[model samples]
Target: MKAVIRITLKNGVLDPQGKAISHALDALGFKGVEEVRQGKLIEIELNENDETRAKQQITEMCEKLLANTVIENYEFELTPVVSS
Candidate 1:
């Protein structure tokens, strides 16, 4: 199984990195972008195949270490691994 997690700063939180990216884009001549919000995408491979158990474990991982729950919000999707 694979867990794909998306973590981003909560609304109203300062995002200096995002701001920097926005500035860089403007300098590069990109137009029409009002804002940029930086985020993290984490993919974890799990030996477990059960969806229920995988979700539970991934949730725990996000809450404990994958994200700063106080300032960041996380959402995840679980997909089955395919072998050729």
Candidate 2:
């Protein structure tokens, strides 16, 4: 099974990296670049056969290691792999 997790900052959190990028864009003459935000994607490939178990484990992993639940939000998608 493969799990894809996307982590993003929560709304109302200040994103300094995004702000710096936005400023650079404006300096380079890029117009209409009002806002920018940064996020992370984590893709994990596991050999588990049980899809439900893998999904549960992935969620735990996200909470423990992949994201900070205090200021960030995370979501994951589980995909089953078919072997030939």
Candidate 3:
């Protein structure tokens, strides 16, 4: 099994990195660009194949270490690894 996790900052939080990206885009003449938000993606391969157990483990991983729950929100999707 595999998991893809997305981590993003909560709304109303200052995102300096995102702001910088917006500014750069504007400088490069990307017109009408209003805003940009930055986030992180994490992919993990798991030994467990059960969806329920995998979700539980991924949730715990996010809550414990992957994300700052106070400032960031996290979500994950489970994907089955294809056998070649």
Q: 24 in model 3: Cα distance from truth in Å? A: 0.3
Q: Please tell me which predicted candidate would have the highest lDDT against the true structure.
A: 1
List the candidates ranked by TM-score, beginning with the highest: 3, 1, 2
- Candidate 3: regions farther than 4 A off: none
Residue-level lDDT of model 1, residues 1-84, one tens digit each, is 999999999999999999999999999999998989999999999999999999999999999999999999999999999966
Q: Which stretches of candidate 2 lie over 4 Å from their true place?
A: 82-84
Worst 10 residues of 3 by lDDT: 75-84
Q: Could you give candidate 3's per-residue lDDT for residues 1-84 as a string of tens digits?
A: 999999999999999999999999999999998889999999999999899999999999999999999999999999999878
Q: All candidates' TM-scores?
A: 0.97, 0.90, 0.97
> Which pairs of residues collide in model 2?
none
TM-score for candidate 2, please give it: 0.90
Better of 1 and 2 by TM-score: 1
Q: Rate residue 46 of model 3 by lDDT.
A: 97
Tell how far residue 75 is off in model 3, in angstroms. 0.6
Q: How does candidate 1 fare on TM-score?
A: 0.97
Q: Name the lDDT of candidate 3.
A: 0.96
Residue runs of model 1 more than 4 Å from their true location after superposition: none
